[model samples]
Target: MSSTATAAPAKKRGSGLFQGLQKVGRSLQLPIAVLPAAGILLRLGQPDVFGPKGLGWDKVASVFATAGGAVFDNLPMLFCIGVAIGFAKKADGSTALAALVGFLVYSNVLKAFPVTDAVVNTTANKGVDVAATYNNPGVLGGIIMGLLAAVLWQKYHRTKLVDWLGFFNGRRLVPIIMAFVGTVMGVFFGLIWEPIGEGISNFGEWMTGLGAAGAGLFGLINRALIPVGMHQFVNTVSWFQLGDFKDATGAVVHGDLNRFFAGDPTAGQFMSGFFPIMMFGLPAAAIAIAHAARPERRKAVMGMMVSLALTSFVTGVTEPIEFSFMFIAPVLYAIHAVLTALSMAITWALGVHAGFTFSAGFIDYALNWNLATKPWLIIPIGLVFAAIYYTLFRFAITKFNLTTPGREPEEEIEDITKA
Candidate 1:
């Protein structure tokens, strides 16, 4: 075969892999969509918000807090089901059911193992034996099980079986296969996950130890990961496992978001910087895109860009605007990533600590104000970043003739929504 033919196949394979990753990334949005409501309810239930002096409804606050906490507590299962349904060929009920079965079996099997903190220290004097929950894999495990369930369902949902097994040959086979596979996975993880888990835990600690520099690196990597959808994995570590705090009830909480909500003064280091990027920087970039459009196309571009800008400002959902220019102007994306790193470092140095349940949007910034340290600083910082983003983006777009929104030729114009 000609080298050109071989190159074509390689290109197709690369495209297929990229598409697969994008699918996984998109799948994560399903579960993440629930966090904002949970965060709102949880915050509303806080003493500073709706408790004693405010609504004077302590019991109601407790109920709201518990209701919201339930979602965070069950994130692993949610991710499992969400990913399964998202990746399944049909997004049907059966795929979700299979994912649940797989996760339950995998988790319970790990629980069955009598693992201790140390191999030789089983006595209470050295270290007490751990509970079944010790084997819990958190959301990462859920994502794995979900992907497995999706794959199994996609491949075996319509497989034929022997005559006696005909009744279970179709959709029913999925859960059955998952149960067996889950058992195997449970045993496999039980044997191997200790070191893996420790490595992740240690990495999280190292990142925390790095302070401002670490936060800066995380910001840069987080933005770069957006295109491939792997940002959520890093987010899981940063938001769910980077720190530890004990709540009023003495229960331990982990991750920046959880610890912040649980009243840890030291939390939110990983989250504070995004406020400027999402709420101001990206919106300004949208403005630059709008300003660079062809004169005749500016009106239509503004209508679309305005919505994207407002979405970023209010909700901190920057994908609409980021995606608009990222592919067409990758250099701009790179610049955005570097600016994010700078923002993280600057925010950390300024002692501006803020937390969010959903994202670094206005809603979260305002909602968590009472719990934040120097929360007012975010506004000034955001404005400065906004100016920087607008100046840089406008200059870059003009110089490069980048195809952002309305700059494309009439025949080649594509929908921003689709991007």
Candidate 2:
């Protein structure tokens, strides 16, 4: 009885942890979803695109750039609000208000007590040496505070107070509580970061120094995590805070995506490798799977596979193709992970630097072309990968008799037909 009881609780704990993490991942998507629009505007406004020199829409392009820049510049604020809304039970305005209040308090406290020695002379700061004044805790901090606010709200939003203190009961109390909590959090982070700043900087340097091998490892792990739906955790760090770059205006940006948009010359290691796989390799694999289907099922499979292939090629949504074979033919998925890693490493070796705000689809590839290094080379490389994927997938499906997609058992197909 004791063993069973203990086992049940343990299982519950594990399940709860997984669900919480998945919630965090879903919450992160709310803010990330806004980036595509921002990216399109920013790219369109580039001087070589629709800006002064290219399309001669100087003032209009500047307006577009400025509007897009507003979103990027305030990403941390948006993240906090988004995370709070995502986590709230009711997802109401109160949660967002508390998140904003917490963020403001935390930022102001950091401004008063800087954590790093990095100084800036931006118009916003006016030559302040306070590291926390401008973009201190950053998106990571915003995420933390947002999570904290949500938890605090969940815990206290329904509490009843003594009659004397009734005015601060329930939902109205969240922001008030977060103000104090944010102050404490701000001071704590500031104290900790003073000694840890060098460590963080060194870690960033180490990640950048890993080069192709690092990107390859990231790609492999990224694909492996898809089955469990946990790739977002790995993605957030690499895309948001992996490397650092200083822009032409002397402002620093972090992460592959941010740096790429800021025109950092060496910011696409984590992103360039995806284009070939999404736009070519996976589509070819889908065709291979369709051809490998039973003669009777080939027609049905082709219709479904064609849509999946086009989705991957145009939007870079590979889950449809990957999931179709992942469960029935696990070996194919394993090979895909390895292939993704190889793609990342190969792209790095070829000095291909490209990026996408959403995914490495045809749209992003074309939109970011002017900013990419060796962008045209992706075509020949993609064609080669297409052939490789098709050949290897066809050979594997035939050799192992892997039941991919339409290759299900005759009994199962008959059952579906009867139903």
Candidate 3:
């Protein structure tokens, strides 16, 4: 074939794949978006709606629970399918089939060996073994498998083979190769998985031991890391780095210490600290900015302030609020950080266990509250944080003439965008 003709096919395939991936990404968005809201609703609305003798409540609750459960349960499957299709050259049904093949191999390998049993034998302990084999197949693993399968499919989907294996060559060969790859991956994971998991668990326990100081540090680091994508890595350490809890029967139970604080028994030591900062403290800071604004720019500043406060309080998206003053007045940002630490300390001291999956906004608060132990205490603590935020912010802005919002000198206003 001529060079142009050969390249044309490749170019066409690449373009087609890109379009397909976009469609797949869009399709996945709806399902992914629903996950958080469904989680919140099921958690918050469950008791009231499913309580004894409630009106049509049981059915409504059951439906939401079932739908949400399916999505939560099948996240790995979704990632495999979504990513395979997303990365494939043709974005065909075959790509999805290859993904399934890879997923099955990866999942089964993790499930095959009981890590807890191995540990038990090594320790010779009659005591309960807290470690389990494997937790749920995560998004990272699924995406890796998907990409591997897509590559295999693209590479060998049309290759010929020897007589006996000839039938398996081409598209049919992708899955067979994936199975072998999965086996190799399984062996690799088996070797290092235990030590890695333990190391992570120890790290988390250490962080938890840091108590209020740790919480403050986490908040500060979390904020700083958001501009980059490293936050997800940090989150993994905080969230799923631990192995499953093992029961007396040697069966691995599906729960982690992190979840204990944020999932059930909801008074997670680390998570509760964010409630005050997100729900109350940030809003108070916004108000202070408004108060500090130049009289002429008060209306403009007020508009920005209101938007920031609402987003912070209702949705827990602090970037808009933080960015508003972060660059212009870094001292104020430092104060915000200090106040966050203080809030964490106060909440920790007061024994509040509030946790949120999204931001520390009211929506997540409402969703997680019902599932949390002593959920009602969050309100009182948050109110206190609000008072603290308002007082400190007002004092600092006035005392320093910090160029917050409207208080920026006219010359500085032109440079605000640059900052």
Candidate 4:
């Protein structure tokens, strides 16, 4: 009967969803944190930066390559631990430990059982080989195990066992349950992952086939999904070995980034487009944010803008600028996405072939410059996008009076929260 009664449930639901996102974000934070180091290491080891592939810096590159690859190769393990810790109510590390155990078991199970035509075949899919050895599901599987282990921890951390099994109680029981669940998940993956892998391969093929157009489309979809945090799934699928790649040494690499690292001849199509956007476009957007701020807050906004701009340029972290206007000016966000797609398409068409361990940024661009087909092209492309971003974002913010970051009214608080 009351307005409060009608609105209270809705408010609770909203808060509940926000909290869930916070948890997921926390889980991803640690695993994502390691990427910068991994990227830097991989870049350091690449012979292109030092000399020619056959004779240049083999010893130096080998050391860093192995060190860096360790992180990328073990991303699933990191994801499992991070997500488990993230989802835990207590966040006491118990869930993380359990998740690690479960993920290991699950990965081993997949390895042991492998794949079969009977298990993987879909009548419609003909090109994919069913007998091919599949890599462990990696981060995808890690996220699943982490979530499951978190549940086991939540239920059994305080659980009391029967008289005969009194020792297997509370924290002790968490691992017990996860061990079985992990093995079951492994079997489940064995049965289903190949078909799913084939599907992802097809998707990657379709994107590559579209060339610049597909890159633009991919850019748009990636940005669209950011609000829900599901963007990571799409990103991982594209960045990792989802499609097949046989390197020069006869090593089959999977995913765009992985293939690039493995010396796959195909080139980094999905990855080439982002360099301009992350290293230049987002920074330009940051500048526009500062310029759009009211005169009174211009100093503060500029300070914020400078920091975020530097971050975007160096590390490809664009959230500080993205979140500032994503909600207030959905139209501008739409435009941003479209422009991002265009950048990807354009650069891709120009035959750029660089890949990054973390994101499209100065570190990856500069360090792997020699590895690319035309690394010099990235600089001009970046400059063009920077100018484009500044012009478009500045005009939109002022013309529409969009409330971005420091431009928000005093009474309206921007929620910096994200998952």
What's each prediction's clash count?
0, 0, 5, 3
Q: Cα lDDT of all candidates, in order?
A: 0.86, 0.87, 0.66, 0.79
Question: How many backbone clashes can be found in candidate 4?
Answer: 3
Top of the candidates by lDDT: 2
Query: Any runs in candidate 3 off by more than 4 Å, and if so which?
Result: 1-34, 44-48, 51-60, 75-101, 116-181, 242-263, 398-402, 407-419
lDDT of 4 at 352: 79
Per-model TM against the reference: 0.87, 0.91, 0.68, 0.83
What digit string (tens of lDDT, one per residue) describes model 2 on residues 1-419?
A: 56555433346658988988888877888888899999998988899877877998898889888888888888888888998989777768889989999988987887767434565786767876544333355678888998998898888988889999999999899999999998998888776755554565576678768888988988999999888777877787788866778888677777789999999999898899999999999999999999999999999999999999999999888999999999889999999999999999889889999999889999999999999999988898899899999999999999999999889999999999899
Q: Per-residue CA lDDT of candidate 4, range 1-419, in tens? A: 86666544346657777767656755776677787798778777777653356458778788887788888778888878887887778768677778888988888888766443233556656644355465456667888898889877888799988989988878888887888998899999987887777777787788778888877777888888786666765676677646677665454556777777777656588788889999998898889889888888899999989999999899788887788888879988888888888888898888878887777888778766766778788889999999999999999889988888778776553344321
Q: Name the regions of candidate 4 deviating beyond 4 angstroms.
A: 1-26, 49-57, 115-135, 248-251, 405-419
What is the RMSD, in Å, between candidate 2 and the native fold over all Cα?
Answer: 3.6
Could you give me the TM-score of model 1 versus the true structure? Answer: 0.87
In terms of lDDT, the poorest run of 10 residues in model 4 is: 410-419
Q: Which candidate has the highest TM-score of all?
A: 2
Give the per-residue lDDT of model 1 (tens digit) for 218-238: 999999998878897688768
- By how many angstroms RMSD does model 3 differ from the true structure? 8.8
Ranking by lDDT: 2, 1, 4, 3
